[model samples]
Every structure is written in C-alpha cells, then in structure tokens.
Target: MEPILALLTAKDTKEALAAFKELEANCLAEPIYADTLESFLPALTAENSCGRGRAFKFFAINARWDSQAVIEKHLTDILGILDDSKAPTLRQCIPYLTYLAEAKPELIPIICEKLDSLALDQYKESMQSLIRRDIEKVLSEFNC
Candidate 1:
C-alpha cells in the first residue's frame, strides 16, 4: 500500500485525521495522491465510519484530478453511501457532493437526481432534518 493510502486507512488515527484535514490542499499541491484514487475506494466502505468519511472526502479532493475516470467509474459505489443507515455517515458524505459538483459539473445532473430521490424520512426525526439540510445545501450549490 502507498504511504498516503496507509495514512488514510489508518483507523482514524490522529495522524490520519490530521492528514484528512489537509487532504484537499495536499492533493491539490501534489496530485500524485490523486493517482491512487482507485486504491482509496475500498476505504469508503470500511467498517469504520471515519474511514468512510475520509474516503468520501478523498474522492471529492480528487474529483479535480480524476483524468483517468476512476471517480466516474466508481461513482455508483461512492454515491451508494447516501443509503448508509447511520445519519452521521450520511452527514459526512453529503457535503462532499458540492466538491464533486464544482469539479465535475457534467456529473452534477446525475448526482442531483440521485440526491433528489433520497428517503430522508428513513432517518431519525432529528437527523432527517439535518441530513435534508445537508442535501439541500449541496443541491443548492448546483441550483438543482
């Protein structure tokens, strides 16, 4: 595994979380990490929700550098997290859609369509509103 991938999948260690905080800037400055996008996909579904959140952000970071279509190819798997049962996970994942929209405008329609179909009622009453806001905020970014 690559050192960066190791850091990202490292069980949400302090170092991992710190790296995740700077991931977008780091990836923008040194795009080599973006080349490893495919390797990070599995982490999106890792048992640890933190890892999943990191992977989602990783995808958002790489959306700008995905010349190889890795993100587009695996988009279904990435978006599948919307259906994740845990509200916290969905909360973590939703905002990244704006990054995807900004970086890959062509995908905005597909992303917006899927988000429109979300079943917010499935979540707890308190969380449903928050998640709806999250989704709405992202949708608003694209004027969807």
Candidate 2:
C-alpha cells in the first residue's frame, strides 16, 4: 500500500486533506498513483467525514484516468452517497458524475434515477436546491 493511502484514514481532516493534495500532486507527476483506487474505496465510504472527503477529492482528480474501473466498481457506491443532507459530500460526488457522464453515457439513466431518488428530507431548502442544481448539471451533460 502507498503511504498516501494511509493519510486517507487519518483521524484529522487537515491531515487527510494534506495527504489528498499530495496524492493529487503526485498523480500529476506519476499517473500510476491513480491505480490506488481499489484501496481508497473504503475511505471514500468511510464513516469519518475527513476520510470520505479526502477520498472523493482523490477520485475527482484521478477518475478520468481510471474511468472504466470507477464505473464498473464504484458507481453505485458513489450514487449511494448523493444525499442532499450531506452538502459537502454531495458536492464532492458531482465531479465523478461528470466524468462518468462523459466516459459512460450508457449509465446516464441509472445515474439520473439515483439522483432523483436522493433524499432531501434532512437538508435545508438552500442545500436541497444546490444539490438539485448540481444533479441537473450532470444529467444535462449526459443529455438525460
């Protein structure tokens, strides 16, 4: 496992963010860093906000390079996290959705359905609106 993967599990958000940034920088210089997706999936769905945020940030940076794996292995998990109540997490998920929209158009309907079903019951009106706007943007990109 890479040292950067350890940072995704860090208890401190700042530390995790720093590690994510480092991984992003390294991935730019060494594309192989993107291959760590399988190891990072657990962190992406972690109970800790920091872990989830950092993992999503990493995927946003690298998803394009590993689009097939992301689509086949993690699409549902990504959609599952699209709750409007978690505004930040919802925001983090949008870029992955965008990448998938371009890379896998066949999945658009499924993604749209999941987006439509995302519960907004716990969110404020403003957050719900923001989530809807983002979801619409992604869906529109796919012509959904």
Candidate 3:
C-alpha cells in the first residue's frame, strides 16, 4: 500500500491506480483500510486528468462493495472526468462511472445527459458497454 500511495505522485497515474486497485483487493476487510482509501480517493480525485484514472480505481473498488455513499459523493467528479474530450481520461473513467452510477441510481438522469452529450463517434464498444451494463443493472434493480 505504501508503494500505491507513491504511485499517486508517480509519473503515470494509470499505473498508480492500477496498483491501488490491486492493494484494495487484498485488503478489503481491514479495519482502517477503508479510511486510508477514503483519504487517497478524494485527493486523487481532486487532481486533473492525470489523476482521473486513479480516481476511477477508487470508484470501482467502492462500487464493487455497494458503497453508495462513496459513489454518490463522487458522482459529479466522475461525470466531470467523462465530460472531458481527453481520450486517456475518458478511457479510464467511463466504465468506472457506470459502476458507480449503479450504486447510486439517482445519478442516472445526469448520466443519461452526459451520454447524450458525448460525440458517439468518439465512443468505442467498451464505452458503449458501460452504458449498456448500467441500463441493465438499474432497470433490473427497478424490476423494469
């Protein structure tokens, strides 16, 4: 985990976030572990696109455990990352945002707005999968 924190300031955030995700997986149930993650997540999230990739890693781990509070709190940050025309940031963020949105279903309306605003030609299948899976999860949750 120490190395992961270092990665936050690494020359590459993509690699750092990837490292953090690995650490989170191994330490999910630790008593103070989530708090450590909480601190890193906000700081990394506040960073620009270089930090966007890392932010998704935090969002993904929190979402996997149904951490609605974490997801809800960062909803706007996730959306802001998505709104960027920067492919590297978008590539790192959209899927994680999709998962985050699932944990906080009330965010769907804004997410849908973001989707509509996207230049679809810029979206590849992976990006499309994000939206599709989100729709399925939310609809299923509503029994629709």
Best by lDDT: 1
Candidate 1 segments whose C-alpha is farther than 4 A from its true place:
none
Question: In order, what is each prediction's RMSD in angstroms?
Answer: 1.8, 3.0, 5.3
Q: Which candidate, 2 or 3, has the higher TM-score?
A: 2
lDDT, model 3, position 126:
72
Question: Distance (Å) between predicted and true CA of 95, model 2?
Answer: 3.2
lDDT of 3 by residue, 95-115 (tens): 555555555667767776665
Decoy 2 TM-score against native: 0.73
- Poorly placed runs, candidate 2 (over 4 Å): 11-15, 28-30, 67-70
Name the top TM-score candidate.
1
Candidate 2 residue pairs in clash (backbone atoms < 3 Å): none
Ranking by TM-score: 1, 2, 3
- Ordered list by lDDT, greatest first: 1, 2, 3
Point out where model 3 deviates above 4 Å.
1-5, 13-18, 27-38, 41-48, 64-68, 119-144
- List, residue by residue over 1-144, the lDDT tens digit for candidate 1: 466666566685777777777766777666766666788877877787776777777888778888888989999988887877778978988888887887899999999999999888888899988988888888887888
Shift of residue 46 alpha carbon in model 2, Å = 1.8
Expressed as tens digits, the lDDT of each residue in 31-74 for candidate 2 is 57555567767776677665666666566556556744764677
Better of 1 and 2 by lDDT: 1
